[model samples]
Target: MALSWDDEPTTAAPAAAAGNPEASAADVAKRVNADDKRIINAKTDVNQLVPFKYKWAWDKYLAGCANHWMPQEVNMQRDIELWKNPNGLTED
Candidate 1:
């Protein structure tokens, strides 16, 4: 009846799991925690904006989209003509 350093415990942590197993299970079964979120391919709802885990990242993405240059703003007629006739442009 002596225990060694490599011996495995035959019992659980008494104080932590004493009589609140139901409470602990409830806590675990709650909504997806922020720590469990990921940048891509997350198990939680990706479209959920209210309880966002990375608020700063979402804001940055919105800012970038707002400040982006749209293709409609540029007149591509000249470029298209030049593309059809590549003789005027240099090879480089």
Candidate 2:
């Protein structure tokens, strides 16, 4: 596909870009205070990871790590040997 411009380009007067009133009004106090922070539409810095506002999230992460398991930690050698043996099972 090809695009063709039949009319000449024209320039219009530049307009000021609108800014968010809440974001523009943000101050250092808002960034430091976690009480005013929220999951969405927060006036504070969302990029900041330090000074955890929700302790429950951190606690849940720690608790979840306790049950972490991997296939490498399990012993499957006996199961594999039994599966490979022809006499281990009948026709069924």
Candidate 3:
């Protein structure tokens, strides 16, 4: 199926606004230390070491949202272009 760049996904609330700060911090700590969260396979280890593959997939899924589609630096450039011209369509 063809993709539609005009349909951008909405960004969720910031972490601070999503929940209580203290609770969110505690949850983050818990997840970081949880043994069950440790890698169980080489695939997981590789993914952690090289995240670009996953990032590319995510970017493709969130196409029109340039913030998510590109890296931080590239996003900044794209943001400026997008601001000047709001249409999300890309040549790709």
Q: Per-residue CA lDDT of candidate 2, range 4-86, in tens?
A: 36646667433433465554355323445453334544456665755666899778767786789787889989888888998
TM of each candidate vs. truth? 0.30, 0.30, 0.21
TM-score ranking from best to worst? 2, 1, 3
Question: What ranges in model 1 sit over 4 Å off?
Answer: 1-45, 48-61
Q: Model 3: per-residue lDDT, tens digit, 1-92? A: 22345666667445655658886776667534333344543234332533456877767656645545435444487667776885765676
lDDT of 2 at 58: 75
lDDT of predicted model 3: 0.54
Q: Please identify which of the two predictions, 2 or 3, would achieve the higher TM-score against the true structure.
A: 2
Model 2, residue pairs in steric clash: none
- What do the candidate models score in CA lDDT, each in turn? 0.67, 0.61, 0.54
| Candidate 3, residue 27: how far the Cα is off, in Å | 6.1
**Model 1 residue 74 CA deviation in Å:** 2.8
Scored by lDDT, model 2 comes in at 0.61
lDDT of 1 by residue, 17-51 (tens): 64888877876686874534444434555556655
